[model samples]
Target: MSQQQDLNLFVDNSIIPQKVYRDEPLFGVITHTQGTSPSWLINLLIENALYGTCVINHEKNQHRQLRSNVVVISFLNDFDFYEKDLKRNGIEVNDNQQFHFIDLFTDLFQKINTPESIVKIFDQLSKTIQNIPNKKTILIEGIEFLLSSTGITSIQLLNQINKLNKIADALFIITGADKELIDIQHANPSLPEFKTLDFIIRLLHRSNIVLGLRPLETGRAKDITGTLTISKGTIPFDSLVVSEKEYLFFVSRETTKLFFR
Candidate 1:
């Protein structure tokens, strides 16, 4: 692809109104993809959708607005979610801020906390954005826990999200997904969803969205396009390129754009 075409492919295209998710069932459709899990993509879609309001408030500057609400919830121990990286880097969150990274999900959404307790947190958040009328946007990080560790079924997660959906106009859950694990159904008996992308496609069938970067290994990006690169030092594009030992993407939506090293 020409540089311009590549750039266009990467840029945020005009939202296809028919394509953008408008209701709960569509959100469901957006969750499941063939040979993959829909949870991670669900979060990505939520972030972008919630971001629209932030963009409107920020005078059409999505990046600046997103940066403001970009809470980097990390599953990595050293990262410890928020204290170590996002806050340390000087990202700030206030009532007027468009985006704020929520690094520590355990701290935010522990099931132990009563619904009332959770409601308090949401209630407090609502008071600040008085003009918005309702708190419709919340981007959640750390979905791998819900999938693998939360000790909850995929249906349960969807139900919980359904409740949250009623409270907020839009919600996104961010989690790490390793497709390789899902691709090998016979080899591993642990994950039932691993057998095919049916799980993912089914999940997304309820939601509307676009896929982001493809998983790959570090240094592979350099090999693919020596001239196209990120300024940051090279690392495995593990999500984009599948290694001999990893799983590759089986489904790619033609309407969605992809960006990777």
Candidate 2:
């Protein structure tokens, strides 16, 4: 398929925010998270906010040393990945602080698709997100969960994105993509989704600081869990490192190393 076709697909999916957030009926805090990268996104955001750096191995650093307003919003399944580091790094959040997650089908059906529950759910979730302090940076993460052919995660994700975008200057870290995206032909399909050049491009267009992970033949690629795709820009489970500047164009493998800095 042509790049325009690919871009069209992405724009079709993501267009709601680009327009809705621009004006009209605004809802609560909105953010996206993938089955992958919850750990890295949370840690990177916290580390950057606190130490102005990235933490490759937490055990090597002084736990008590971090001091910053860091909030990690994660889904139920992936919460454990960052739980230990969060406590060690002095960031704490109650269950209420985390955004409630659902898939796109449910979001459309129960929330948007249906007339009754959608607004109610949005109101409740929005209130929950709104209560969080605006000045503090929040790491929003949630699982899109596996959906059947009939199921959808888009509505729920859009809700989260809508909610979060309301807060000015909030460093929103969003992850996740349509599982079927890989079936599409991306220019550089060799790279992982999270690390793909297009993924970085789309991410940097939306976010201020983007760090995507791509696996290498060696190094930390072995244990890291996730699939990376350039065309789709979503991963099954893998690691990647992406930066804001590199997102707009072809990024060399060596350039990804800069994220460690």
Candidate 3:
């Protein structure tokens, strides 16, 4: 990809539509390949935090926005490990209040063994958000992880999200889906065996906005030239609009530019 192509990927006027940042509740599902990391999701979260928005993340150990108001609830690793990881990723952690790491591999297993314990966990999450005075944007990295860990039904997870949405006064709730499973189902329509893929479909149906990320067509080793597709939702620009349609986007480390494919 040339520099012009990279520049063209960014939305015109160097501004995303106001509707993209509106106060109304927005639920988005981002689908990405399994082996490939979803780096754009982190970029989006950091951008939101740069604008002074409070981002509450429930995800694995990854680079976090180095802002005091950005809260991360890490389940994959310990606090020290996350801090080291962030530093390695070129992100500086100036604020001590930025992370709240919960080692699920150790602590969660000890406490949350039964279904009742799972309910308490959800209750605790709800209460934590309730105590925070302002509106929050919750970004849950692995919906599949939650399902596999707790053995909770898809309907139950949806209910938990709904409950959190109500208590947190959440402006947006963003979660991820597995694209590899989706691709498998798409390739072979005759053999539909993955229940996890079915749950992801349900999630996409439930979301107001759905964005998909895929590797570049060239099959490069690095995630240099990927595609972003808006499978649903309409975001209105100043004079132009993107609605009720599928739009293609070119994504890089620098920018995500959208255009009609």
Candidate 4:
């Protein structure tokens, strides 16, 4: 399929309102468990970059973008991994001037415990934003990993996000947690170290848009099922209520559709 067609299939356009990006910074949370796959979210991020939306990728380079406008920052992985993945994803990486990869792991990891180092990283991020053109969307992946690895608190991350929102027109974040563990914690209500759940809840409280993806409960092999919960946002279709509402969705490689059922 063409790239445009692939982009359309990656997301359900009916669930997103027109010009929603204009009103507020778009924040998205995508959750999945250990066994489930989050490739759909990765595809969505790539689509955004391919569509000429500036992307600041931080997902550790599981995928690649062909567009020169996409900039990737590799934290946990090496630059070669990103180059290989980009090629695997059909994105050419032949000394492309537009496509850039910044290796942050070496410098940041050496001084991860120092407050000065953290501040330096944040300063670098700010500088990068300043250079980007105005009114562009920034996609951030692996937020959870960043926090856990760097020992950054939720408040600190939120503050960084707020800063990014001030500079960028829109922002989308992708984070994942184990669904089964969350369920076990929910049922027990006494499990310790619900850190993932706590982080997810805190982020959700601050997010304008939220999406959850998991495998089908019925064990169906054809499609994945999840819930798309919207709160304090507008959607394109009138069928979606403006207020907080949860809609069940089926996602396959071919398409993504939302419904009440």
Leading candidate by lDDT: 4
Q: What TM-score, computed on C-alpha atoms, does each candidate reach?
A: 0.45, 0.44, 0.63, 0.60
- Those runs of model 1 whose alpha carbons end farther than 4 Å from true positions after fitting are 1-12, 15-132, 184-201, 216-219, 223-261
Q: Write the per-residue lDDT of candidate 2 for residues 36-149, one digit (tens) a residue.
A: 343433454555444333333223254433333444444333444455555554445334333222323324333344323444554665576566552334455432331111
In model 1, how large is the Cα lDDT of residue 138? 52
What tens digits encode model 1's per-residue C-alpha lDDT throughout 1-261? 312111211113321111222332112121122223433233333334434322112233445323112223233332333333333223333343444443444464464244455445445544543333423455444444434443344554455555544554434443333465256546442364442233343344554332333334443332221121111112222122211111122223222222332
Give me the runs in candidate 4 sitting further than 4 Å from their true place. Answer: 1-24, 52-90, 93-108, 114-116, 179-195, 218-261
Q: Evaluate residue 14 in candidate 2 and report its C-alpha lDDT on the 0 to 100 scale.
A: 23
Stronger candidate by TM-score (1 vs 4): 4
Task: Report the error of model 4 at residue 254, Å.
Answer: 12
- Find the 10 residues in a row with the least total lDDT in model 1: 225-234
Model 3 TM-score, all chains together: 0.63
Local accuracy of candidate 3 as per-residue lDDT tens digits, 38-97: 544444453344342212222224343332233344344455655554544345555544
Q: Sorted by TM-score, highest first, which candidate order results? A: 3, 4, 1, 2
After aligning candidate 4 to the native by TM-score, how far in Å is the CA of 27 from where it should be?
Answer: 1.9
Name the candidate, 3 or 4, with the larger TM-score value: 3
| Candidate 3 Cα lDDT to native | 0.48
* Deviation (Å) of 56 in candidate 4: 22
> Model 2 off-target regions past 4 Å?
1-38, 50-71, 76-81, 88-119, 146-156, 177-181, 185-205, 217-261
lDDT value, residue 27 of candidate 3: 55
1-261: candidate 4 lDDT, tens digit per residue: 211111221133322332433553455555665445555444445445544321222332434333324444444455676666555555555665555455666665576544446656767786886686534555555555545456556556566666656665445565666653344435332242244466667777766665555555666554336544444432232233334555555665454544553
Prediction-by-prediction clash tally:
59, 36, 2, 2
Give the distance in Å from residue 134's predicted Cα in candidate 3 to where it truly belongs: 1.4
